[model samples]
Target: QKEVEQDPGPLSVPEGAIVSLNCTYSNSAFQYFMWYRQYSRKGPELLMYTYSSGNKEDGRFTAQVDKSSKYISLFIRDSQPSDSATYLCAMLLYGGATNKLIFGTGTLLAVQP
Candidate 1:
């Protein structure tokens, strides 16, 4: 099984709507969960990061993680057309000589004006 799994959704929403993105992982060793946004032809940028199991909010974005259930989520409020992009869920396994990072397939989102 993949360490992290996310629905590759071409999800469409209207302006000002709230958007929810989710991912599930099989690795209990993951210590850091992050959400990244990637625009076409651009590199993925970190949007949110959460350590352990908890929630973190930044501006209109909220990221949540549940280590017990091995699930994570990202919520965007007041969606805008500019928010259209691919959202990737990533997890970091910290330990050993080197840390490891794994990413989901990514979910595509489009917000209409």
Candidate 2:
């Protein structure tokens, strides 16, 4: 199995719909989970970062990590067309300060008008 697995979703929804994105990893040594949002032709911007298992909330975004299950999820509440972007899930190994990131293939999300 790949170290990380995620569906490359081109998920389209109406404006204001809730969006859920998820990923699963096989590595247990990964300690940091991150979510990044990227628009066309642009590098990804960090949207969420969490160390270990738990949930973090910011504005309309929520990120959840379950180290035991090796799963991570991002929830976008009250989504908008402006929220349309490719979402990437990334992980970093423990005991690293260099911030080397291992990324999933990413899911493309589109919120229509």
Candidate 3:
């Protein structure tokens, strides 16, 4: 089974709506979790970063991690059309010589005006 599973959503929402995206993992060794937003044909930029398990909120975006359940989620408040992008969830396992981020299949988000 894949270490991480995400909804790979073309999740559609109205501009000003709240959007929630998530991923579940089978691996419990992950020590770091992150959320990245990538525009079409562009590289992803870090949106949120958390160590272990916790919730971190930034502007309209919130990221949460549950180590016990091996689940993570990203919440976007007041969605905008410009927010349309692919959201990626990534994690790092501790034993590697260097942290190699394992990423999920991105979830595509579209905010319609």
lDDT (CA) for every model shown? 0.93, 0.92, 0.91
Superposed Cα deviation of residue 38, candidate 1 (Å):
0.5
By lDDT, the best candidate is: 1
TM-score of 2: 0.94
**RMSD each, Å:** 1.0, 1.3, 1.2
Clashes of 3: 0
- lDDT by residue (1-113, candidate 3, tens digit) is 88989997789999999999999998777888989999999999988889857888999998888888889999999999999999999988777587678999999999999
Candidate 3 segments whose C-alpha is farther than 4 A from its true place: none
Q: Which residue pairs overlap in candidate 3's backbone? A: none
For model 1, the superposed segments whose C-alpha errors exceed 4 Å read none
For model 3 the local lDDT of residue 51 reads: 88
Q: State the lDDT at 4 in candidate 3.
A: 88
